[model samples]
Target chain A: MESFTIVSGTAAAIPLPNIDTDVIMPKQFLKGIDRSGLGEGAFHDLRFDAGGRERPDFILNRPGWRDAAFLVVGPNFGCGSSREHAVWGLKQRGVRALLGTSFAGIFFDNCARNGLLALTLDPATADALMEVAAGPEPARLTVDLTGCSIATADGRRWSFTIDAGRREALLHGRDHIATTLTRTGAIADFEAGHRMRTPWLP
Target chain B: MPSPEPLFPHAPDRQGPRTLYDKLLDAHTVCSLDGEERLLYVDLHVMNEYTSPQAFTGLREAGRRPWRPSAQLAVVDHVNPTAPQRTEDVADESAAGQIRYLRRNCADFGIELIDLMDPRQGIEHVVVPDLGLAQPGMTILCGDSHTTTYGAFGALGYGIGTSEVEHVLATQTVVHRRLAPMRVILDGIAGDGVGAKDLIMAVIASLGADGAAGHAVEFAGAAIRALGMEGRMTVCNMAVECGARVALIAPDAITADYVRSRPRAPSGADWERATALWARFHSDEDAHFLREVRFDAAAVRPLVTWGTSPDQAVAVDGTVPDPGTEIDPTRRRAMVRALEYMGLAPGTPVRDIAIDHAFIGSCTNARIEDLRAVAGVAKGRRVAPGVRGMIVPGSGAVRRQAEAEGIDRVLIAAGFEWRQPGCSMCLAMNDDVLPDGARCASSTNRNFEGRQGRGARTHLMSPALVAASAIAGRLCDPRDLP
Candidate 1:
């Protein structure tokens, strides 16, 4: 995983609330066994029409926002499905973070583990940033995880809060599996005690 | 979505009356790490074809094997066909490749798999509980969000992502952050025509989509205790639609009886010991909760979603909602979009909404009891002209049992297709997809955009309501039949 410290780029605004994983990465894209080339499949239905032609009206397909690194999304974004493919496709398409008022439980965890910053903001503050991102001129924003704040080119800033553990892991690019493996002795000891108490467990 | 400050923060000493969620976390804890995050042992980890291929690939790339192969189980459901006749060969090459990769990886790691040809094969959530793999006082995890279904049996179960899947495969434990507890009390008996699906749908509609976010919800009270295992499973399964990470029901005689009757359950002395331990898995009378909500079950009616999200639902007798009445700007716009997508006019009766398809199957409501309910509504009734109705059982066991009870014949005679077991038309990963612009009355969990197919519209209801709607060629409540 890539460490996420600070990033600055164009921010696209998708203000539709509850844009679920099915919409982010449709079922057709999930057939792939590996994680490569998923950028084309990210938001396939929204970005392209039935004939596979790009829809000119979509924000991500418009000029100046085609390569947005941040998404200013609506409340309860990514609210369905536990498919990590949604996160992978977003990262592949060059999105490094999502700013929303709230997010679904599973999708938020997926973003944390995969190094995509899923920031939760108060509704008023999120709405303010959303306005800037959706403006006619292409909006540019900078996210500084070290300072826990998001800033625009005009020097306006909004501070965010994140779980201390998740913030530490994102800053260091930690591998959770490797970290858990080092506690093998503690796990085995716990298992021994647990099994003795409930002998019927498989 | 964070819970309100708890009365007992951490409860480190394990003193005082504790919630079922707190007890489960303490029983499974391996070690306390960072604040609120601990290494918790997973007694069972379920996997399906779609979300797990990448995890297995990651494990191989790292040259690591499963720490405890026996703790995991895999099945093929999401990307398989559900035609009348079952076959080992998948039609789509990419889907077939995924199944093949899963088979190879499970074999390499020494984990057990319920393969396509196995009679026990079904949706992971459906099959695991049917086989008695989900028991009280157990901590279960799966790569699919519906793993909350196992909490129907008093188990501590929730969903995880593929990265967590890799971690669980390499180590039989995953990090956990304790969720604030919420108890949903259901009082009074639900009248005729009201079922578990309707009750849950009503709850979701009232609470909104993210109502239970960041909370571990437990269903309790008189009406909940009266429901059988299948009803309980239906309620717990859709709790995820309301953003609950875990949904639990305390263990009782019904749970004990169901677990004991399963093939894989312990017998005789071992059973006695197991039941004794499970008796203590419920919350103490004075257990603390961050929140509590009560509902009158008698007020519930058969529910059908009018919009893309599960929360945008109303009773079967209700009319379409006008976005102009909504106060929130974002929510009002969402309602307008949903109404346009559904092709429904404001104030129109839901019964006037005609459907092209009626699907009766999913992990949510495809058990034997559910099929029996559908059969009761379909027997001696004919499906309306131009309506295509189908019933895919949850597992082979459920299909066979329904067949022996002559439920299949009744449904088939009524013009409904009796198909093989898989998650058909639920997520539409298989060939059982609805065409563009087609409307469906489905007994499934989600009503998201393009859930059944691109440009397809879905109205989610119970199995009985689905059958009643199929016969009427519209969204009709079961009580309105004949």
Candidate 2:
């Protein structure tokens, strides 16, 4: 029910495919019912070893991407399980938006519901962006959802499209429940008509 | 152009168009059901190590036990270690505790438990169908949203919160609403190189992530029929992503064949009777749905996720879009933010993005078939330098079978790690994790922030794509390999 705008932080590039939900917020974290604290378990395997030591070679250990809020990935992002925790983890970790070639269906909905931006681009454009982002002195990609375009600090830009209804919801920070609630008048009217026609029960 | 005349023109006009919640109320007959109009006869209930402990606690607190233990199934998958077969090697005490709790709860409640050591033990979603526990014409509920995976068996499957879990445990039912039905009929044979993953991706792309919100989706047509049960599961598994309460495919010969061999399935005359019942369960030819959509299977390709949402996808060979010309500021901002997080620039080539790691394992695609697909790609091929990779099977049986087929040998020979069965690295619950700033090609789900590890950049792709990326040390199409 709450709405918030996401601001991109550092741009980190991970060009891979089939990143499943388990990797996003491993199964161990799933034990808890509360949505909070999942950020800690986000990518448990890649961050540590069998002995729980951190993997120094992982991208998250690198200084440049430590605070990255934007994730550039390959195709079929969020493909495996449909765990809303995955999205909650990402949002809690401050990832405001994701750029990939494709995504898993359930993970995509989680993103939209949580107010995260998931933008799809062609593979070629994604590759070029990864190159620029991996460079020194961090390149910035501006996500203006209301404007429906992505611009980089260097003036390069990309245009994307979304369903008008979804676009409106994102702009207004409304989820499906809120969208449905907006039709209260119609629902009330329907209930009234039903009462008159059937009138057997309250 | 002109909004394409509203995709479902007749949708609103058909009986005033009910929402999923509305349909659920009608199905349950909440208004007319006797005695407070509570839920009765739960369709399905799946439990995993992660969420079952607290549910058991709630049950005990209420001085109630499982009403119909036969309907519930529990499995230990999330916390089990992917390596070190000995249970003692489970490094995380918390996970070990949960596993123990699930085992005890199952024994106490008389619910079916697929323990780690059991040959049938595996990811709950994978093992359920593998064992024929899921069937057609059932209303299934699980603690996990991926329970929708069972929808492939022609049943309604969705996730339930812990409270609902307790409700089901005590009363064998829970309050519910029905979902408006959305029928998606695929018209043609899938072209070469396209798989169930691609088919689902195409569906999401066409409908957008929220297109099926509050609907129960029914997938029909030759394309869906042609898929094996495993393939069907992959397609239905992500129904939640499309915002549908569930996704289902009617039962058929394939379903019968798959279930007949399972240990739990009926035998001889019983099997025949069960099949008869299943046959009657299919939607009648004249059955109607609230909405209908059609697609050609031949148009789909091996897909990849370029954005955070499943609907934000493209064929593997495409490039990032330029957001400057976009009309919606919200979408434009999303694209820009996605590019930034992914370290991508506008107008960049997507194929050129490199990878540092490759992973294959998860409930979604870590079945035996998935393992075989990766093995096919990894055979006689070495992982690219600087790219670390691993393969975790969904179950102990899959692990044993892969080893029997020398798939492990091929993987290890190709420099891929062959670990034991457990949810590893996929969500970083255990010791598996990506190092800081290490970009990885993973076959698990969700490429959200820190999914692989803290600040670990993840790219979601199919198993074959993960294998291909592991070999190329970059995001390359599986079709482009070999």
Candidate 3:
């Protein structure tokens, strides 16, 4: 995991609401055992066409997004399937943060473990951010987790929300697994206590 | 600056009665990080080949072993071909490689695995409960959304992502947030042809998708209590489609009877004690619910999803709804896209729409009871000409039961392909897939864009409706036939 305090970069946009995990990384790309090198397959169905050629009109396929480091998506993004390939695909493609009005519960949790910033903003701010990022000139969007706010190159700012635990982990470059490891003693004590109550449970 | 008000004013934190969800989380909390966040111990962890490989790889990369190997179990389902015998034969090369990888990983990690050749091998959702692994008052998880299926037994089980999967493998727990609770109460008995599938479909359609976001839903009322374990499973299995984190039913005599004498279930005095403990796991009278919706089960009819989302549904005999009927802009846009993709018109009667395929099987509705209902409709009849129909059992045990009663024979004589036990066509991860531009009536859970296959259009319905649709060569109601 990498520290994710702040980042300012060009933002790509996917305006489809309820854009589920199946669309993010389709079933066809889940065949391999390794999770690496899957960015090429990200958004396969929407990114490609019947002839296996890239669709020219996809938001990510445009010239302004070639260097995109962030994504502004619609509500309920990553709504289906529990595949981490969706997060892995975006992270591999260099999108460090996602700005959305809302996100699926599991997808939002997955972002925390991978050090990918997931910010939930009010609908007005989200719309404003997307409008600025989807511009012809490719406005640079700045997301500062430490400051708990997002801003565009033109100086419009909006405060967002993130829980203290997730904020602490992202700032310190730690994942939940590492945090749990640090609490090994407590976990062991809890397991021992649990076993005493239901010795029959497997 | 301070917040305007408490996020959940009536929650147990304010001395109010706690929800069933609260009890489950509190019982499993190993340690708390902050308000509403904790490392909750996982009692049972189920896995499948499609999602577990990378989790195992990550565990190996970090030089870690599962915190509790005995608490973990793995199965091969997503890519498993439903072809008969298949004892150990996986048809596709890539699928076989993944299956082999699962076997190797399970053996290395010392976790119990239901392999492809095992008689108990099936969808994780069905296998866990059939083997008595999912029980009351437990916290379960899997890397599959239908993991909500376990909630039928009064357990708390939900889907987790691969990253969370890896986290649970190494720690035997997951970092979780306290969730708001909602109760859906069904009061009256359903109509003659309506079933649990219809009831759940009606609930989702009424609320719209994303209606229960960030909440755990408790299903109650006389109608829910009257349903058998199989029917209860059908309802809980689709809870995720409503954006609910999990779905639960309070334990009762029916639940105790269902868990009485299975492989992993307790025996003798242990059974009596376990049941008594589970009996106390229900919500108290003073419990608080963020939102409550009541339904008259007698009013529900056989329903089908006409569009991509499960919430985009209508009665089986009704007409497709116009996108303009939706007030929310996002919902209107989604409906428009769904209609265009499905090649349907706003006023088109659902019964007049023809389909290319009729599939009756999935983690959502593949229990033996589902098979019996489908067989009851298809017996002594033939599938309409040019319509391909198939029945894939949920588990090997379920298939054997269906065969002992000659359900397979009835289906075969009715022109339906009697396939083996696996998650065939529920997801098009293997050989069972729809061709481009094909329309299918599926018994699976989700009906998202290209879910069945690339360029495929899916109509979600109950097994009975699928049978009737196959027999008529169109999407029709069961009551319309026979």
Best by DockQ: 1
Cα error, candidate 3, residue B464 (Å): 0.6
Candidate 2 chain B lowest-lDDT run of ten: B29-38
Stretches > 4 Å off in candidate 3: B1-16
Model 1 docking grade = high
- RMSD per candidate (Å) reads 3.7, 12.0, 4.4
Displacement of residue A49 (Cα, Å) in model 3 is 0.6
Estimate, for each residue in A64-167, the C-alpha lDDT of model 3 and write its tens digit.
78668888988888887888888888888888998888888888888887888988888998888878877777788888989998888878888888888789
Error of model 3, residue B433, in angstroms: 1.2
Residue pairs in clash, model 3: none
Report the lDDT tens digits of candidate 3 across residue range B1-482.
97754322223344557677777777777888777777888999999998889889989999999999999999998998887557566768889989999999999989999988899988889889889888888999999888888889889999998888999999999888878899999999998999999999999998767878888999999999999999999999998888888899988889888887889998887787678678777888989999999999999989999998888899987899998888988778888999999999999999999998999999999999999999999988889999999888999889899999999999999999988778889888888988889999988888888888888999999999999999999998877886
By lDDT, is 2 or 3 better? 3
Best-performing candidate as measured by lDDT: 1
